[model samples]
Every structure is written in C-alpha cells, then in structure tokens.
Target: MIALEKQLKDELKRFEAKEESIETIFIGGGTPSTVDPILYQKIFKLLKPYIKTNAEITTEANPNSATKAWLQGMYDLGVNRVSFGVQSFDQDKLKALNRAHSPKQAKIAVLTAKEIGFKNLSLDLIYNYQGDTKALLKSDIEQAFELPINHISAYELTIESGTKFASTPKVRQEDDELAFFVAKEITKHGFKHYEISNFGSYESEHNKGYWKLKDYIGVGAGAVGFLKDTRYYPSTDIDAYIKNPLKIKEESLTTDELLTERLFLGLRSNIGVDKNILNKAMKKRADFLVEKEKLFKDNNLYKNTNYFISDELVLYILG
Candidate 1:
C-alpha cells in the first residue's frame, strides 16, 4: 500500500486536473478488503482536491472478507460504493465455482455495507458456466434483488488461457439463448442494460468512462493507463515497480487501431459509436447494418441492438 500510494502521487499528476475533475475512481479486480482501510486513507486524502465532489468512489470486495468493521472503515473514508464479488447465490454452484463465501456471507456483507450508509451497492453474477439453467439463474437474481443493491454485473464465463478451466474449456457453455435469457430476467426488474454485462438502476460512471475511452491512471503492477491514443504499462513485476515506479512501457495506437478499439468498446455498451468517427467506407457499412435492423441509428450515433454480436458488427465495420 505504501509503495502504491507513492506511485499514485506521481501517476495522478499526468491528468491535467485543471481542465477536468476526475469523475470516478474504481478500486477493483483484486480483493480490496484483504488490506486494511487505514492504508487507503492517505490515498483518499491526496485525491480529494483533484476529484469531483460527486465522484463515484467504488471498491470491489470479496464477500467472505468484507466484515461490518471493514465496510464501516471504507464508508468512513468516503467510499460510497461497494461491488461485492458474489458470483452466485446457489451454494452448489458457488462450490463448483470455488467461491470462498457462502450465500449467507454474501448477503451479510452487502447488508453490512448498506447499514454503513453505502447508497450505491453492486454485485457480480456470472452466467453461461456449465450446469447453468434458467431456473438456477432466476433464483440467483431473485436472491440478489432481495438485497439493497442497485446494480448487478452479469458476466458470461470465458475460458482464458492458463487457468484450471482453460484445459477443460467446455466448462464455459456457449449458450446464446441463456445469454438472452439472463438479460431479459435482469432488465425485467426495471434495471437498464447499459452494457453487455452490466445492468443497474444507477449506472456506474467508472464503467461508462472506460467505454467512452476516457483517460484514467493505473498505478498497480500490470495495471494499464491511457492518455489520448497511447497506453502506458507500469512494470508488472511488483518488486521492480516499487523499486523504480517511474519506469513504464508505452504503446501508441494507430488511427485504425484506435477506431477499431472505439467501435468494439462503444458497441458493447450504451455509448454508441459516433458516425463522424467512422471513415466513408466504415460509415456506409454501419448504415447498411442499420438498414438491415442489425443496428439502429439514433441521430449521429450507430448502436448495436444486440450486444452479443458486437464483435461481428465491429469486424464488418472495420472491413
């Protein structure tokens, strides 16, 4: 935490805060609750002036570790949002997924955060894993809505290389119908389907900003930072990063590469791709999809009606 704080102190300077206040700060991907909240205090204190007053401060937590005291400690630090990694409510499924927390613990963690005055609460629910059925997912969603959470991220299971599941990739069931079923089930509860995998009454600015290609600081090992068309990779080696935090590898994207990226990210979320950003050939292809009802045009923006085919749509447009 100390090394991270020192690195962040320098990294955050890259953003010209005079032009715009930081809108969102996301502490995610890892188990944030494992560390003491007291460790985060200095970082928050440092960020106060550069961040907007209404900035959505979110921290991702594991339900098994986020106790009431931990939740309270984070709440006291101006952390207004908690996104628990509660993959499912089904005990059998939880065990199958190798989750640490039980359904009871997940519920308790969320309630504890709410009790600590967290207004924006979210949890992740995974689908399309082997043995997932409509009934099982329905029960999971029902259990989730019973909590005081305002948001849910429903992610499809994908077999990334090098994980245990990678050897048996079939564990990630390729069921398109189940994907549609999950979306319908979640949105029927009155939440907006803002992204391919996210549904919520209160949308996450941190998430939207990423899709819109906004610049964000990335301080931790292997974390990525974006500024305009270039990406910065801090040393993934933790010891090297702490020893010399200034050393970073940079990659600058070409116009085509940047456009390709924008299309993929935009089409996967509520942020539609701007027609002006597309070249003449790309614009014509997008217009053709719009006419074919595969995509819908809202004024100057071309949006994918079905997010499942976002990759195909982008590839076609790029061609």
Candidate 2:
C-alpha cells in the first residue's frame, strides 16, 4: 500500500506539471475507502501543492466499508466529499444484486458519515430491478431523504453484454419507467435534479465542473482524464497501473462529437441547452415538445418540463 501511494503521488505530480489546470480530483473506483487513512493523508500531502483550495476531493466507499472511524480518518485527511454505494434499501433487492451490506447497515453508514462531520455526502441508489414496484421505489426514496445527505444519484439497472444478467432475462422497460417515477418523487422532496442520474439539494461544485466540460485528472486503474481538448484513459489492468502509471492511451474526440457531447451534457442540467446548437429539425421538434408542455423554453435555451426528466427528454430529442 505504501508503494502504491508513492506511485500515485509521483503520477499526480507528473500530470500537474504536464497540464496547467485541474479543477477537480475524484479518487474513486474499486473501493478507495478500503485503503488506510495514512496512505490517503500521504497522497493528499503530496498533491496539496498542485490542487486549488476549493477543489472538490471525492472518494468512493461501499456501505460495508464506510465505518465511522474510517470516514473520520478520510475527513481528517482532507477529503471533503464522500459517495457511498448504497444500491437499495430493500433486503431482497440487495440480495438479488449480491450486495455486501444490509439495509440496516446502509442506514448506519449514512448516519455514521453525518456523525463524522461530512457535509457533502452522496448516496447511490439503483432503480428498475426485476419485479421492483412503485411502492418499493418510493420507499427507497423516502429512506434516502431520511438520511442527512444532500445528494442522491439514482441509476437505472442496465444489463451490459458481458454481465451475468446479459444472458438472463430481466426487467428493462419496467426499470426505465421506475427510474423516471423515482426521479419525479425525489424532485418533489426539494432536491434539485441536476444531472441525468444525479440529484442534490444544492449544486455539486465538483460535478458541475465535469458537466461544464472543464478539465479534471483521474488517477487509478481504468481511470480517465481530460485536459484542454484531449482525453485519455489508463489501462484497466491493475498490474499495468501499478507498474506504469504514466502509460495513458490518448483518444481524440471529433468536432461533431464534441458538439454532441456538449449538447447532451448541457441538457441534463436545469440550465437547458442553447437553441442555436439545434438544427432546424431539432428546433421544430423542440417547438412541438414545448407546445405539448413536455419541454420549457426560456430565451435561447430549451429544458425538460421537469429537470428530473432530462434523460427521457434527451432520448426523445436524440431519437
């Protein structure tokens, strides 16, 4: 672990020297909270000189690993934000998803984080499970609000091609509908539906940078980085990352692809997308949507009727 910390520190210095600006740093993926707090402190100390004072430093933890002491250690080490992987509050659903923590444990984790003085806390919830009903989803949302968290990220269960669920039949359409329903319910609770799958009582400065297409540097296995107009990703292999942390494969996004990404990411916010970016056909479609009350138009931008339905609106517009 100490050796890995040293490698990470070295890589962060290299990136900072190579890139001029790095607005946010996200230390997530594969249970970062499992590492010792001292290692985190060491890493932070090394990178402190390069990062801005208001930089959003985020670390991810599984509910099972989010102990009170561990959370306190992370907070003491300069981690300002924490995101937990609490997929659901239903014990049956948790079991089906092969989660490690129970519903009670998940609640305890959130309470512990609050008790440990974490102001910017976020919880992850999964929706659209097979056999999941609206009542169950509502219960989940109610439980999320019960926590002192300001942010909630609700994700629709998707079956990827290589996953075990890919070969097995599961609820896809039902989950999509349930995701929408959950979004609406949460928005009514005073949380701002900021992104397609992210909700918060207040805006997330860290994520706002990403949605605004600002530069960020990610360090870890399979981590991605974006600076200026170029993007790159590290090898997914853990062994490769440990050996050669600087070996990043670069990829260039085309002009049209960049414009499409900007439009797509922008529409996810309540801020809406610029009307000038849309073609004549898209503008016509937007007019029809606005007339149907499915969309709201303010000046040169078009937004979803409910900011929570940004995903559905994006699909409708892009389709």
Candidate 3:
C-alpha cells in the first residue's frame, strides 16, 4: 500500500505539471476504503497544490469496508464526500447480487458516516433486480431515505454482455414500471433528480461537474477521465497501471460529436439545455411532449415533469 501511494503521488505530480486545471477528483473502484488511511492522507497532501480548494474530493467505499475510524481519518484528511455501495436493503437481494455487506451494515455505515462529521453522503441503490417487485423497490427507496444521506443514486439492473449473470440463466429483467416507481418515490422525498442515474441535495458540486461535462481527473486502474475536449483512460490491469501510469489511451472529440455530447448530457439535468440548441425536429417534438404534460417550458428551458418517467422523457426528447 505504501509503495502504491508513492506511485500515485508521483503520477499526480507529473499530471499536474502537464495539465492546466482540474475541477474534481474521484477516487473509486476496487475498494479504496481498504487502503490505509495514512496513504489517503498522503495522496490528498500531494494533490493539495494542484486541486482547487472547493474541488469535490470523492471516494467510494463498500459498507463492510468503511470502518468508523477510517471514516474519521478520511474526514480529517479533506475527503469531504463519501459514497457507499449500498446496493439494496433486502438481505436476500443483497445475497443474490453477491454483495459483501448485510442490510443492517448499510444502515450502520450511513449513521456512522454522519456521526463522524461527514455530511456529504451518497448511497447507491440498484433497482430492476430480476425478481424485484414494485413493493420491494418502494421499500428500498424508503430505506434509503431513512439514512441521513443527502444523495441517492439508483441504477437499473442492466445485464451486461460479459458478466456472470449474463452467462447463467437468470430471471427476466424487472419491468419498466418498477424502475419508474422507484425514481418517482425518490424525488418525492426532496432529493433533486439532478441526472438520470443520480439524485442528491441541490449542492452536489462534484457530480454536477460530471453532469455538466466539466473537467475531472480519475486515477486508478481502468479509470477514465475527460479534460476539455480530450478523453483518456488507464489500462484495466493493476500491474500495468503501477508500471506505466503515463500510458493512457487518448481520444479527441470532433466538433459535431462534442456539441451532440454536450446536448445529451445537458438534457439529463434539472437545469435543462439551452433552448437555442434544439434542432428543428427536436423543437417540434419538445412542443408535443409539453402538451402531453411529460415536459414543460420553464423560463424558456424545457424541463421534464417531476413525476414523469425518466426513460420516457429521454426517449421523447432524444430518440
């Protein structure tokens, strides 16, 4: 761990020297909580000079791995935000997903994080489990709200092509109705539906940058980063990352692609996109959606209805 920390610090120094600015830093993937707190402190110290003071420093942790002492250490070291992988509150569903923590641990972690003076807490919830009923999803959202967290991220259970779930015969996907129900319940609880996959308090500076397509630096195996018009990603192999941290695959966006991506990401936010950017076809459809009560024009910006289904809204606007 000590050696890895040194390598990471060295990489950050090199990157900072080359890059002009950084808006956010996200420490995620492969159990960052498992790393020693001292290492975290060192990494933060090295990053202090390069990162903006208000820059959102975020780290992901599994509930089982986030010990109380570690949480405090992280707080003292300037980690203002912590996101836990609390997939579900149902023990059976947790087991089915091969999660390491129990439902109780999820609650405990939230309380503990709050006790440790970390106010910016985010919980991850997965909906559309193979057997998830609307009742179960509602219970999950209710449980999430019970936590003292200000942010909640709910994702649909997508069957990726290479995962174990894909190879094995599994039950059918949870119907769209259940997924929409979960999203609606979350908004009713006062959390802002900032993005399609993320919900939080109105002050989510870190994630807001990502949603707005701002610059961020991600450091870790298989981590991807977007800075200005360029995108880069590290190799997925751990050994490869440690050996040659500078070996990153890079891509530059074309002018047309950049404008399209900006519109795509901007439409996901509550702030909505600039009305002037809507093409002729999109303008006609947007008008129809407003009439259907699926979307509304507010201050010249088209915004989705708070109770409207997210996927339907997206399809209507973009598809």
Candidate 4:
C-alpha cells in the first residue's frame, strides 16, 4: 500500500505541473474489489484538487469480491460509478467462463451497490461464448435489466494468445449473426448501442473519453495514456514502476496514423467522426456508404448505421 501510494504521488507531479484537469478516474483492469477500499482513500485525497467537481469516478469490481462494506466505502470515497464483472447470469455460462461468482451473487452485488447509493452503476456481460444461444443471451440481458444498473458492456468472446482458450480456439462462439442479434436485443430494451460492445441507458463519460481520443494520464504498472498523437507508457514491471513511476516511454504517431485511428474509433462508437476530418477521398467513400444506408449524416458528423460491420466499413472508407 505504501509503495502504491508513493508511485501515485510521484505520478501526480506531472498533472500538478501541467495544471491538468481530470474529468474521470477508472480504477480497473484488475479485480479492484478484492483490495481494501481504504487503500484508495489517500490516493483520492491526493487527486481531489485536480479532479473536476462532477467527475465521473468509477471502480471496476467483481460480484464475489464487492461486499456491501466495500461498495459503501468506495461510494463514501466519492466513487460515483461501479462496473461489475457479472459476465452472465446463467450458471452454465458462469462455469464455462470460470467466473468466481454465481448468478445469485451477481444479482445481490448490483442490488447492494444500488441500495448503497450508486446510481450510475454498470455491469459487463460476456456474450457469444461457446454454445451461447439467442435465448441464453436474452435471458442474461433480461436479468441485467432487472438489476438497477444503468449500463451494460456485452462483449463477444475473443481468444487472446497465452490464455487457456487460445490453446483450444474452438471454445469461442463468435458468429457474426449472433453478435448482431445480441446488439439488437440489448437496444430493444431502450439502452443505446453507444459503442460496438457497450450499451447504456446513460452513456459512460469515462468510457467515452477513450473513444473520443481525449488526453488522460495513466499511472501504475502496464498503464497506457494518449495525448494528441503521442502515446505514453509506464514500466510494466511492478517493482520498476514503484521505484520510478516517472519513467515513461513515448511513441509519436504520424498524421495519417492518427487520422486513421480517429476514423476507426469514432466510427465504432456513438461519437461520430466529423466530415471535416475526412479527406476528399474519404468523404467520397462516406457519400457512397450513406447512399447505401450504411452510414448517416448528422450535421457535420458521419455516423455508422450499425456498429456490427464497423470494422469492414472503416477499412473500406480508409483503404
């Protein structure tokens, strides 16, 4: 705890020096609920001054670990949002995913968070896993809506290298038809399909900050940050990061690379890309897509009609 606090304090020096205004803080990428919420008290205190008055502070938690006390502690510490890794409410699916919590635990966790005063809660659901049917996915979505959560992140299972599933890649149940069906089902319940993998009654500012390509400070081991066309990375080694949190490696992106990123990222989410950012060739392509009803023009921005084929559409426009 002491070492972590020291590292965070060291990282604060840069934000302090630049007089940067932080609008959001997401404590995620790992099981944060397992750690004592008191551990974050000092860190939040240190960051209080720089954070916006209405900052959307979020913490990711797991159903098994996020106890009522833990939820209350984080809420008291000004964490206005909590995203639970519920994945799915089906027991079979939970076992298949090797989730630590049960369906009952997930339900209880969300209810407890809501009762404890977290109005802006979100939960993630892993859909399109092996043997995931439309009925099973619908049941999961129905169970989530029964909870008090305002946002849902339903992601298709992907086999990443080094995971057990990677060895038996057939364990994945990703089909284009199933993925599209899941998106349509979620949106039918009034949640906006704001991003390809994200649906919400209310949009997530912290998540949107990423899709919008906003500059954010990333601290701690394995954290990455983006500023304009430059990307920043701290040491991935925990001991090295604790020893010198200020040591950062930088990567500068070329104009074409940055524009490509903007087009792709913007097209995949509700945040549409501005036509001004598109070149004559890109705009010409956009016009063709609009004529085909694959894209829509809203004022100056060109938005994808459906995020299901966002990748292929982006490639077509950019290529």
| RMSD after Cα superposition, model 3 | 3.3
Candidates' C-alpha lDDT = 0.90, 0.77, 0.76, 0.87
Q: For candidate 4, write residues 1-319 as lDDT tens digits.
A: 5655665676566445243288889998679999898888888877877887788999999999999999999999999999999999999889888889999999999999999988699999987788989899989989999988889999888888978788888778658898888888888989999998999988999889998888877877888877767898988887887777777898999998888888888889989889998889989999899999999999999999788788899999996
- By lDDT rank, best first, the candidates go 1, 4, 2, 3
What would the TM-score be for candidate 3 when compared with the true structure? 0.86
What are the TM-scores, per candidate, against the unseen true structure? Answer: 0.96, 0.86, 0.86, 0.95
Q: Over 4 Å off in model 2, which ranges?
A: 1-22, 169-175, 275-300, 306-319
- lDDT string for model 2 (1-319, tens) is 4544655665566556533244466778888768878777767776677767666777788889878888889888777788999989999999988788999998998888888887788989988778888998899999989988989988888887866777875645454566678878988999977887889986677777777677766666787777666787877798877777767788888876666676677777765778887778777877888998987889988876565466566766665
Q: How large is the C-alpha RMSD of every model relative to the true structure?
A: 1.5, 3.2, 3.3, 1.7
Give the alpha carbon lDDT tens digit for every residue of 37-117 in model 3: 887776776667776656677779899999998888888887778999998999999999989999999899889999988
- Tell how far residue 2 is off in model 3, in angstroms: 8.6
Q: List the residue pairs that clash in candidate 1.
A: none
Q: Tell me model 2's lDDT, rounded to 2 decimals.
A: 0.77
lDDT of 4: 0.87
